[model samples]
Target: MAEEELQLEDGSKKKKLFIIIIAVVVLLVGGGAAYYFLMGSDEAVSEEMTEQGADNDSDESLTSTTVKTGTALYVAMPRPFVFNVPGSTRDRIVEIKAQLMIRGSDNEEKAKMHVPLIEGALLRIFSTANADDLATEAGKLAIRESALKEVQIALSEITGQKVVEEVLFTGFVMQ
Candidate 1:
């Protein structure tokens, strides 16, 4: 009777072990299947987005290249322009760092070739600014516009085209 009881206990333990192993195997297979499906869906979505982006790019490239001939470029002045301006209270000293935005490589080369002339033109424009006017944003914009016009005129006379599309003031200081 004792031997039969021992045999029944051993059978129950083996059955429990078998059930645990089967559960673990089922979990691993389910997890692997889930990972495979999720990864495949992400790849398909990315491929679709890439194809749509390519189509948009093709449409834009045609219109953009025709409107603008060359890539935009910036040419910086060798030194900042430092000068004095008269104010209602007293005279103030000003410094301006400038750059030129040109449309194409041809214009860039033309601008580089005539840096001295550009500097002189800008200096003349800056010298006329009033300290009181420089303190205001509108005054600063007016001065910038004047500088652009002056530079364009100067370059146009030499290069037969406005080599500079814009005059950018990168830095400004007052004391």
Candidate 2:
């Protein structure tokens, strides 16, 4: 009986070890296959893009006529604008945190260099807003548009280009 029991235990241990080895092999093979498929596809795509680019060199002039914008960058104001606006019933204090969205590194540098001008321009626009108008969505949009225009005009005078593409209000509070 003891010898039979020892044989049975040895057989079960071998079975478990064999199963574990098979599982490990399967996982490694699956991982290798997945890596090959994913990495191979990226290389294929990059090669295709390079070939297409080479073929499109002569067509560059046709595309060049269209205005191309550069990468978008944001420049945040150093401080938020705090002001008082008169509403129908009372005067409310408002705080607006603004960022300037510009295109290209050149525009980014120009905007950073003249942040004071941009801030002043934005403050002038924000100060003109009515508290009641600011309570609605359309009023906020109107102010944003006015701010963009003012900043562009100010930047254009100094940089000879519109350094700012948009005036983004990151935060707004009314009390």
lDDT of each: 0.86, 0.84
Please provide, for model 2 over 1-175, each residue's C-alpha lDDT reduced to its tens digit, 9 standing for 90 to 100: 9999999999999999999999999999999999999999999999998887666554643221122278889999999999999999999999999988777897788899999998888888888999999999999999998888888778778877767767889999999
Instruction: Output the number of the lDDT-best candidate.
Output: 1
lDDT of 2 at 14: 100
Task: Report backbone clashes per prediction.
Answer: 0, 0
**Model 2 accuracy (lDDT, Cα):** 0.84
lDDT of 1: 0.86
Q: How far is candidate 1 from the true structure (C-alpha RMSD, Å)?
A: 10.7
